[model samples]
Target: MTATTTTLRVGTRGSALALAQSGQVADWLSSTVGVPAELVRVRTEGDVDRGPLATIGGTGVFVTGVRARLLSGEVDVVVHSLKDLPTAAADGIALAAVPRREDPADVLCARDGLTLAELPDGARVGTGSPRRAAQLRAARPDLDVRAVRGNVDTRLGMVADGTLDAVVLAAAGLARIGREDAVTERFTEDVMLPAPGQGALAVECRLADRHTGPYASALARLDDPVSRAEVRAERSLLGALEAGCSAPVGARAHSDGVRLTLTGLVIAPDGRRQVRGEISGRAADAALLGRRLAQRLFDDGAAALLGDLPLRAAAAAGGG
Candidate 1:
């Protein structure tokens, strides 16, 4: 198989972390397939606005621009954090690859080196995601959770300055930018289930849009088949729930040799109650595993908890 040596544009959001992740993708593509790939920085509406994310459109404001560039042929490939990709696929585009996954759980970045348990009552924990915020409240109902927004660096700075006692961040985002030191503690699966597809990368490309065909295929060699299956199941759960990306839902999927297991949760905003369910099935029926989990939860009263969210949850928090 021949590799493409000509220039290939890879579009990515222009955040420090986004660029770093994109650079890693470019490095993998170039070294694995002999394609000369460069990162094309794109400014997204999410990056420009400092307002509340929920008030603005919640359709992953970060990845839309990059996807547009890919659709227009301005870039041959676009790499995005899997959590940022919508459950709905775009027309003319395919999620060609999912290149493994990192720690999918949220991490706590606290001041004075305190863990979630060591923190005092009424201590402020900052987060923008409803799932994290609801989980924080559930874990420590006495603590205060403020909605926070910004790039990873900006949010971490709040803890550094003592404005916030702690913050919840995606472990993968911390790892991508060499900011693992920012984490005071990694939330365990039992305590805080991650957002669906939280730690993987989605490689999007047009259907049969090959740049030096065989080389393109080889570069995609980085995709991990098992991780792809896990994310598919988790995303299917999200789709079945009809919850937007901002909804207070948490899901995780794991596969052993014999079966795939999916655990899902829907939390009320006040943290007093939540609905949880799990399902196991043949690995080949991962999507069914997710749907089954959803059906069980709904039958068990998840709909009442998530229905009319305001009665179930609080108003959105913070401006970034």
Candidate 2:
């Protein structure tokens, strides 16, 4: 299809970060494929509800609306924050591309420039993610970990207004929103392993569109082999674990084009118990490496550690 014959409609959530990420993709599509691309803002249930994420649903909440639009032919393509996407595959849709990733580390956006360790006892740390909360408690048992939910600016506003001493957020989100300077410190991987597919964007299209659609060539240009391999390994681990976004699980994968290494962590919600493991293999065996590492973690008592959490069950059911 020629540029004048097709206008690629890219659907995205109507959030600042989502717009920023989708805008970048739209521009790339237009320039690279010589096709006119436009952004279609889709409001998700997650965006309308202000309750805790786990209570409303899990990560899939942000994706359902947009995916429906893609499947219904309202949009030709969609962009998603990789971390917000469930590990399970959706029928009728395909992940066509994963562009180069940004830094996947979680960062401390603390007031008064206080690092996690330097914060006073009982410091109020705001985060809605179970993984971040568990890590915070594990590192500083004295902290007052509070459940807070909002967009990036709203979360930052709490700290700016003295309602929260600090807030834990993805370094990638902050950087994408041009607020990286607000980060007090980017936590080391040992301190806080990032979520599966964090710091990446998932560009998806209808399964039927991947090979013969007008947007196929443009989407193909966005795929980064290294990022795709690394995120695939991490997400494969998550899928094997049968854990959802609400589970206190952390994973990060790295690839040097030839070899890939994946680290997986599962921590008790109360931060009392944790299991960690790592596996390395040829980059071509990324998915296998992730599954193997997950099995190792289960052998290390990850199942028992997570068995009692109702949130895990809720996430699984919601994803279905």
Q: What tens digits encode model 2's per-residue C-alpha lDDT throughout 1-320?
A: 45546787999999999999999999998887777889999999999988877777787899999999999999999999998887778899999999999999999999999999899999999999999999999999999999998889999999999999999999999998899989998999899889898899999999998988887877887899999999999989888888887678999998999999899999987787899999999999999999999999999999998787666665555471
Candidate 1 local lDDT, 250-309, one digit each (tens): 999997635788999998878778999888888788888888888998999888877865
Whole-model Cα lDDT of every candidate shown, in order: 0.82, 0.90
Report the Cα lDDT for candidate 2.
0.90
lDDT (Cα) of model 1: 0.82
Maximum-TM-score candidate: 2
After superposition on all CA atoms, how large is the RMSD of candidate 2? 1.3
Model 1 clashing residue pairs (backbone)? none
Residue pairs whose backbone atoms clash in candidate 2: none
Q: Each model's TM-score?
A: 0.93, 0.97
Query: Candidate 1 — number of clashing residue pairs?
Result: 0
CA displacement after TM-score superposition, residue 5 of candidate 1 (Å): 3.5
In model 1, where is the ten-residue run with the lowest total lDDT? Answer: 311-320
